[model samples]
Every structure is written in C-alpha cells, then in structure tokens.
Target: MKISFLLHNAYGIGGTITTTFNLAQALATVGHTVEIVSVLRHRERPNFQLDPRVGLRPLVDLRQEKEHPQHLRPAKVFPAAEYRYRQYSELTDERIGACLADIDADVVVGTRPGLNVHLALQAPERVARVGQEHLTLDNHPSRLRTALRRAYRRLDVLTTVTEADAAAYRRKMRLPGVRVEALPNSVPDPALPPADGNAKLVVAAGRLVPVKRYDLLIEAFARVVAERPDWRLRIYGKGEEHDRLRALTESLGLSENVFLMGAAAPMEAEWVKGSIGAAASNFEPFGMTIVEAMRCGLPVVSTDCPYGPGEIIEDGVDGRLVPVGDAAAFGAALLELVQDDERRHRMGRSALDNARRFAPGPVVAQAERLMEEAIEARRAGRPVSQDRAPMRQILVGRGYAARDAVHATGSSALRTVRKGRR
Candidate 1:
C-alpha cells in the first residue's frame, strides 16, 4: 500500500510531526510505501529525522510566497485565525488537488483540520482520505468547526488523539457519514540509561505555551523548594511564554533553583538527568512528554488533566497525579517524592513496566489494525466501528480508575474513502 501523509509544516519540531514521522516509518518497515507531503515549508532544515525509505515532498515554499510590505500598517499575521477563514471562503486554486496529482498513493492522511478539510474537499476520487486531529474539537475556532462539519461528511475517517476529543466532534459536528477514532501519539523507546543516584532534579519539557502552563509548574516548584531547598527544577523548550515565566520565577525568588533550560537537542538525554518528570498542562490531548519520561525510567508527577495524564499515570503506583491548577498539591507531591528516595526508585521501575503498552511495536500494530478495518469497511460500503475498547475494562484490569488508565488502549476506528485517480 502506498500511503501519503499530509502535514501543515514538516520543518518544525512538534508532537504531531514527530508522531507522524514515527508512524510513517513503522508503516514502511511493515512493507507499506509511505510518503510525506508538506503543505508549507518554513525552514530549510527538516526538524524530524525521516526514515530513509519514506519519500518527502513539499507543496509551497511559504517563505517565498509574496507578502505585503511590513512597513504598511500591518494586518494580523498570515495564517492567523481570521486569515484561515478568509482562505477557506475564497478557495481559489485547488492546491491540494495539484499535490495529489503528483502521487499515486492508496491512502492519503491529512494531519490537521485545514489540511483535512482541503483533502476531503479537493482530492481526486481515487485516493483514500483519512483526517487526523491532534487537538480537541473544543480547541478549534467556530469557523473551522463549521467547515469540518460540512467538509468532513465527505471524508472516510476522522481521527483524534483522545476519545474525549472524538466524542466532542461527534456531538458538535453532528455529521452523519463521518467516523471518529482515537489514535494517540507514539514515541520510540529511549536509548539512555537511568540516573544511578538521586540527581535532586525535576524536569519539565514542552513549548512555553499557555496550555502547557509552565508558569504553574514554576509556581509549584517554588513551593517544593521551600520545603526541600536542595532539589532543583529545570524546564526545557522555548516559546512565547519565556519572558513572563522567567519574570515569575524571579518574582518568587526561584530563579536560582528553577532554571529555564531552553530547548535541548535529543530531549531524551535531558530526561535521563532528572530524578522525576513533571507535566503541568491545563489540558493535554495526549501527554507525549510524560510517556517519554516514563520510557526513560523517570517517574512522572502530572496533573489530572482532562484526557491524557489520568490515562498514563497509575496514581501511587507508577506516578502521582494532583488536581488540575492545584499548585500546592502539585508541590507537595513533588516534595514527597524528592524526600523519599526509595519511593522514587520504586515508582520509576513501575513506570518503565507501564510504558511497555505504548512501545512502538504494539502501537504500530494497533494502527495497522485500524487501517485494515478502515480499508475493509470502505470496500464493503459500511460504516467503520466508532465503539472504543471500554476504558473501564482496561482501568479495572490495571487497578486504575477512569482517570488513571491513559495507557490502556490507544486505538481508533476511522473510516477510509478512496478517490479515483485522474
């Protein structure tokens, strides 16, 4: 099978890009031909290391695209929410169609909402169209939501990272022909060894965005520092919230103990240096970082966020979970782990055991089953199954509740529609 992955920007380092690259490589290794098609290329260097077997193509050089002079009273940035709506309204050229003409793949998967709508609406009739969502439906703007409702009815399968996200789409869009599935992100196992001794260090990593809530992590760490002055916190990754978060750290007099360690290359190496991992997000569609840390044998302390953390951590077993936005509770949890060396080691060992479920081999096998199911359903002119493996069954078996069974079964059931080749 020839599979084409349509991504918004393949040049950047993001969870969506990393997961797509990993899945594509796994599919290729299993004897399927895979190609990546980027709609916009922003940088000369590819941030992800693609499998040599995978083919890569770019449709538009965004840097080269003509723009109005910046000296003029600047309108909002291109590709802003308003600009995306305007682009949707005035669909002048069929860029997606032109790109599809360049490839003869059995399946074409779109990685984001705009690309999904474009592929569903514009692709020829010979290619199977699959739309994958990395964020929740509630995160989309109203205009994009409306467009998805109208355009997605034409798509074969609509995939999201979480079951909660897929359910939201079903309820909000109310589209008949669309099938929603949950396909969480997967990462390769870490190659590094765990730290031998207590590093007295906690690590947090992600883009410094509002949703990531790194400020919350800093505040929580400040409280932890008050109790255990020897422990330190290090946050990796750079983004818009850098200045504000830095200022907050200084205000709390945590600048010395809490270091904003900017973006690090090969993040897995950084995880090895920490005694524990932290994920302080308001909502995580799928907490890839948490799993990454676990894979590196670092016990994690994450918030009981809406979808992912509860699924990943087996509270008091592999890791601890505090209520969302509760900095005090988060601090106490970290401090407890810091003070108790034996508990941290026990939890770290358990985390490694729990992470096996998300190992690339199992994850790719699940993906292959989903693809086969979608293809068979499409050929038979039937609807793909949207019923998920029960979270309760998975959690109960693992001695977890609804909130602590994140790693149970990360499977999705998206339908595939094939468009005829020109």
Candidate 2:
C-alpha cells in the first residue's frame, strides 16, 4: 500500500517530525511505499536525519517566496489570531487541495491539527484519511477546536499520544466519526552506555517555548545549585525564549551553573552524560524526551502534568513526579535523586525496563492494526469493532464523563459507517 504523511515542517528537529519520520520508515520497512509531504521548506538543509527509503516532497519554498532582501527585515507585527487564521486558509487553498488532487495514495495521514483539518476537508473522497493530534485538544484555540469537531466527521480515524488527550478531544469537541487511539512516540535505541561516573548533571531538552516552562526549571535548579555547588543543569533546544531565559538565569545567579546548550545534535549522547532528566512543562501531551532519557538509562524527574508523565513514570519506581509549577517541590525531588547514587541507579534500571513498552515494533504494529481496521471497515460497508457497544461502555467505565462517552461512541459509529462503505 502507498501511504502519504502530511507534516507542517519536516526539516526541523521536533518530536512530531521525528515521530512521523520514524513511523514512515517503519511502514517502508514492511514493504509499503511511503512519502513525506512537507508544507513549508524553510531551510535548504534538514536538521534531523530522515530514512533514505522515504521520499521527500516540499509544497512551498519559503525562502524563495519571501520578498525582502538580505538586510531588510520582514514585517514582524501582526494580530496573532488573524494571522493564524489567514495562514490556515492559505494552506488549504494553496497547498493541501493541490496535493490531494495530485497524489494517489491508499491512505493519507495528517500529523498536526492544521494539517488534520486540511486532510479531513480537502482530501479526495476515494482515499482513506486519518488525523493524528500531537497535542492535547485543550491546547487548541476555540475556533480551531470548533473547526476540528466538525471537520473530523470526514476522517476515518483520529489518533493521539495518550488516553487523557483522547478523552479531552471527545469531551471538548463532541464530534462524530472520530476514533481516538493512543499512538505514543518511539525513539531509536540508544547506542551509548548509561551514565557511570556522574558529575551531578540534570538535563532537560525541548523547544525553549512558553509551554515547556523552562523558567520553572531554572528556578528549581537554582535551589539545587545552592545546596550542591558542584552540580549543574543543562537545557538543550533553541527558540524565541532564549534571551529571556538567559536573563532569568543571570538574575537568579545561575549564569554559571545553568547552561543553555542550544539544540544539541545527537541528543542521545548528551543524555548519557546526565544522572537525572527533568521535564518541567506545564502540560505535555507526551514527553518524548522523558522516554529518550530513560532509554539512555537516566532516571527522570518530571512534573505530574496533564497527560503524559503521569502515565509514563511510575512514581518512586521508574522515576519521580513533582506537582506542576512547584519549584520548591521539583528542587527537592531533583536533590533527592542527585544525592542518592543507589536509588538513582535502581530507578534508572526500572526506567530502562519501562522504555521497552514504547519500542518501534509494538507502536508500528498498533498503527498497522488501526489502518487495517479502517481499510476493512471501508470495504465491508459496516462499522468497525471499535464502535461496538462494549467499547463505549468501557470508555465510560474508565472515568470519562457521560457526555464525552456518548460523543466518542457516536463518532465510532460514524467511522464504521463511512469506512464500511468504501
């Protein structure tokens, strides 16, 4: 079967891009033809290495399309809401519609919400369309949420990284024809050995964006630094918040102890040098960095955020979880792990054991099953097994609110009907 992946930007080093690339490669390895369709090609070069078997195609050359000369700066001030809306409309008109009309694939999957909306509304009727939501539905703007609730009616399946996120989509959107499935991100197994000699380094890695809450990590690290003068904290990733975070570090007298290492390539090697991993995000849909750190056998200290960390980290077993946004608690948690070598080692071993659950093979197998179910439902002109009454009851029993359970069940029913027809 031929499959096409639609992504916002494939050239950058991000969790979504990496996961899409890995999944595409996994499908290709199973003798399926896979192609990546990037909406915007901003750079002449790609930062993340992609599988050679996967074909790359870019819809827009952003650099060439710009009108300003080298020294001249483009207008930076614009209404955020209006600008986003305009960009979404333009994507549908200029790229998405054209791509759908040209490509003849068995299935097409959209990797983000904007692209998901496009795939559901613009893709040809003959092809099976799937929408993958990388972030929780709660993070979406009001307008986009309404659009997705309506647009998802056209999609065959809706996938998210965690059960909590899926439940949020079901509750908030109240949409039909959506089958929310858990498809967590996977990483390549680490080649480096676990940290043997630790200089008491704690690492956090992700885009230095507001949602990541790097500021909170810095505040927490300051407390750790005051107690253990020899320990250091290293944060990797580049974004608009660099200067602000640096300023905060200086203000906190953490200029020397906290290092803003911008976007480290081969992040696994960096993870191997750390004794502990930290994820201080306010809300993380799924913390891929947590798993990456665990794969390198580093015990993690993460916030008990909305969806991911709570599900991934078995508190006090594999790692520790502090209350979200509590610098004191986070500092205390980090200090506890940092000071105890035996406890850290025990948790690191457990973390490595837990990492096996997210291996590519198992994740790919789950994806394949969803695809096959979609195809079979389309062929038979009947609802898929996912829409059965028992499943609906189970979702309700699992603590999903009443209204959400109804919406999810209805969506599953619709998906079965639409897919069964094909």
Give me the candidate number with maximum lDDT. Answer: 2
Q: Give the C-alpha miss distance for residue 93 in model 2, angstroms.
A: 1.9
**Lowest-scoring 10 consecutive residues by lDDT in candidate 1?**
413-422
Question: Could you tally the backbone clashes for each prediction?
Answer: 9, 9
Q: What lDDT score goes with residue 77 in model 1? A: 20
In model 2, which residue pairs have backbone atoms overlapping below 3 Å?
Answer: 177-411, 237-263, 377-419, 377-420, 378-419, 378-422, 381-420, 382-420, 383-416
What value does the lDDT take at residue 38 in candidate 2?
86
Question: Stretches of candidate 2 above 4 Å error?
Answer: 67-92, 387-422
Give each model's whole-structure lDDT: 0.76, 0.77
lDDT tens digits, residues 34-67, model 2? 9999876789867887788998998766777433
Candidate 1: misplaced stretches above 4 Å?
A: 66-93, 195-197, 380-382, 385-422
lDDT of 1 by residue, 1-422 (tens): 77899986788878888889888988898799899997667688687678899988876565664242321222222223422333321211344556766668877898877777667877666566788988778877786677677788877788887767877887878867667767667777678786543799999998999989898889999888888888899999999999999999999998789999998756888999988999999899889899888888889999999777876777887889999999999989998898899999999998887776666665665566566666666666776666655543534553544433444454231101111221
